[model samples]
Target: MTQPRAVYIHVPFCAHRCGYCDFTLIAGRDDLAGAYLDALQAEIERSPLTEPLDTLFLGGGTPTQLDEPHLQRLLDLLRSAFRFSPDIEFNVEANPDGLTDAKLDALANAGVKRLSLGVQSFDDRFLSVLERRHSSESAIEAFGRCRSRFPDVSLDLIFAVPGQTLADWQHDLQTAIALQPNQVSTYGLTFEKGTTFWTRREKGQLDQADDSLERSMYGAAMDQLAAAGFEHYEISSFARPGFRCRHNQVYWNGGEYLGFGPGAASFDGGVRWQNHRSTTTWIRKVLAGEDAIGDREQLDPEASAREHLILGLRQIEGLNVAAFETQTGFALEPLGGEALSRLQDQSLLELTDDTLRLTREGRFFYDTVAADLV
Candidate 1:
């Protein structure tokens, strides 16, 4: 009777796909909305319910893209699946264009207490370049509306876009600060394969910022956000006190969660499963009384320990050396001795009270450091 502490629902519908997004999403599939909800409900019902969920996250394509009735139906399915904690942090991700009053009302009634808005940039030009449908004005208006409804609001921003100067990045940060969101997640643009930007780059239609410039932008964001009283809790996430994303923490801390919907990923105990990415395939399987899972992997102890190291390093709080040993039965020093020694000698890591964490400079070269450990 193992009950999940967190639940994640993937809503794969979006009005239009952003050029830079590589997430599993379907564009112009609003026609599949009804069937998708039904399948999701069926999937949840089939899942074993053993615990009250502490956190529930509705991440997307755009959860707000669903109509009122569909959204309500999904929420109802969740409520039926497991009992929610009295103080559960229910989070929903919304694009600016979809954050209408009606959607907000539906979310509020559904008990969603946190809103994570996708506001990639405050500059209109950058917005256009990023293929975001919302204008800067609309994003600001949406944030204000969300603030009036949800107790906790997080704003997502992207920095280090091609041709973006340091001043431009700083301006975006300053604008986001003025909005006074409860949390801010700043990420650098990665040219993910299969994304429009990746193809464009290959064809010389788009350029990526140089490493030095990207590093500068990252440093600037860290300094600015910290000065604004946001905790650099994770590599790309910053939050005010008591506002760190609890659902996300579950994943980073190696806890179990159940994911539902097309292209969703789930981890329970030591088994990991991913659903089919195609909306049609997912709906067909679920309607046929079969799970939509396309792949399943049962992690061995060594693989799981390596994952713990990788994910834990993403958090600024770093990994507890002793806990890592207990969880995987593999001592951190033995598994990553050479890399750890090199990093420590370079002053990129600090060991205090059986915990190993990155220094400020270490965070900048995190990819290199993480590779060494692997």
Candidate 2:
């Protein structure tokens, strides 16, 4: 197997947990930040990278939630622990509320090349509905700060909120485009099983956007972002030329990457594993020199092929048939079976001699398409 050239470090601290979030994170856990860093350093020390990494991602509940000193320590620890390619794409996820100037300076000085700001909406109404602490003005200010500090920045936007109209989503898109970010990621809101949103939805306290409205909102994003000269490179991602997010592309391409910290996941040599979700539990295990893994799965050839295809189709460029067969050692036709033909027949998929990609219609129904194939 080839050596992995990417790494992901999860920082599971946040000031407040959004009602819709189900990610592995603890709100009001800043007290544990120091120990978490210590455990993270130990985790990296145990399995140091053999080669300089091409890309690294610091993601979390909110990485910037740490104070300047702790944030600096986290950055310095990662830099000292691993060698980095001079042109490495180092990214950090940040929320608008607590992104202090000191934290921004620490990230910039530490060679963070990209910032993925969680600016869910520019509308204060939607922002409050989403339980985000930052206002539209504050988010815009944070974006300005990020732009000054990083060469490339990405804005994350969520649409199809319970009361969001198409015009409201369009306004948010326009707000993001006005900032001229290097990239943008747009996602429709989802009520995951364990999130507060789900319970509220079940109780009829919260209503989700209906299918037609959701579809229209998604279509508007595709049209508006594209018109603004952003390439719709992936289903939910738009990038200006030459600014695609390298770290996330690694995942979509099914490349191996090492992950550390609680709830972090790693994929290598056809095997995948995740660290424990509970931050305290993970810190304790790593400090005690025990494995922090919570789950592990080894995929056989067929399973791996299925996974590769699923991940590959996420990108607008789709899967290259010849390369998929060569890499997975399984023919796409046989692996995809009748479902492939059915999707094509439904005009939800497009298949040619060399590539297979989702149709514009399919992009909106991606979950359904994945379900059929999976």
Candidate 3:
């Protein structure tokens, strides 16, 4: 197998946890910042890098939440651990509130070339409901500042808010486009278990948008972004030509990557492992010179084949059936027979001579289609 070319570093600190977020993150506890960086460095040092990383992603809770010194220390450690490729795409996820000029400078100096800002929505009401700390204005300012430093910038937006109208969602899309970001990701709201939104919905305090309305909101996003000259490369991601997120593409394409930090996931040499989700436990284990991984799975051929099918379908361009078979040593026809037939009957999928891709309607219920195949 060739050396893995992607690296993912998870920084699991947040000023406050969002009501709907389920990603592994801790609220408050700024004191642990140094220790966390130290632990992260230790983990990176212990792991081997077989090649200069072509892509590196610093995702979070919010990577920008770390103070300048901590951020620098973390970056310094990464620089020491791996030789970054000359054309490497180093992406860091930032929340608007944490995107100070100093932090942005630190990121640039650390060789970060891309920024993914969590702009959630341009509407203050929706932002408040989502427990987002940054105002839309602040997000705009942050992106403006980032543009001066990073070559590529992406904004994340969520549609299908409870009580959100089509016009409101359209306005959000327009607002993001106005920012002129290199890329934008529009997502529908999902109520994950254990989230405040999930509990509220269970108590009848919150209601999800109707399925039809949500679909319309997604459609509006696609129409608007496509009009703005962004390529809808992935289902949720729209990018300018040549500005697609290479690190993310690695995951969607089933390429190998190494992840570090609490709740970070890694797949390399056909093995998948996830670090412990608890910050305290992760720090303690790493400090004790122990592997912080909690669960490890070596995917069997069939499971790996299934994962490729599921992940590949997420891309708007889909996957080549022949290439999929070669990767997994299993034919796609037999594995996806019933599911593919049903989706095709519904006019949700189209199979050309060698490729399979989603139609517009299929993209909307992609999860359902993917589940049937799995």
| CA-lDDT, candidates in order | 0.90, 0.93, 0.90
Which residue pairs come into collision in candidate 2?
none
Model 1 Cα shift for residue 234 (angstroms): 0.3
Residue 280 of model 2, lDDT score: 99
Candidate 3, residue 65: CA error in Å? 0.4
lDDT of 2 by residue, 1-374 (tens): 46789999999999988989999999997999999999999999998787989999999999999998899999899889999999999999999998899999999999999999999999999999999999999999999999998999999999999899999999999999999999999999999998999999999999999989999999999999999999998989999999999898999888999999999999995999999999999999999999999999998988888888888889998999999899999998888899989999999899876999999988988877887776
- Give the Å error, residue 335, model 1: 1.2
- Report the Cα lDDT for candidate 3: 0.90
Candidate 3: stretches off by over 4 Å: none
Backbone clashes in each candidate structure, one number apiece? 0, 0, 0
User: Highest lDDT, which number?
Assistant: 2
| True-vs-predicted CA distance for residue 103, candidate 2, Å | 0.8
Per-residue C-alpha lDDT of model 3 across residues 1-374, encoded as one tens digit per residue = 67788989999999999999999999898789988988888888788786999999999888989988888888888898999889999999999987789999988998999999999999998998888998988888888999999999899999988877899999999889988999999999999999999999999988899999999999998899999999998989999999999999999999999899999999984799999999989999999998789999999888888888889989999999989998889998888878888898998888987989999889998888888887
**Could you tell which candidate, 1 or 3, scores higher by TM-score?**
3
For candidate 3, the 10 contiguous residues with the lowest summed lDDT are 41-50
- In order of lDDT, best first, we have 2, 3, 1
Which regions of candidate 1 are displaced past 4 Å? none
Candidate 1: clashing pairs of residues: none
Residue 317, model 2: Cα distance from true site in angstroms: 0.9
> Least accurate stretch of 10 residues (summed lDDT) in model 2?
365-374
Give the backbone clash total of model 1. Answer: 0
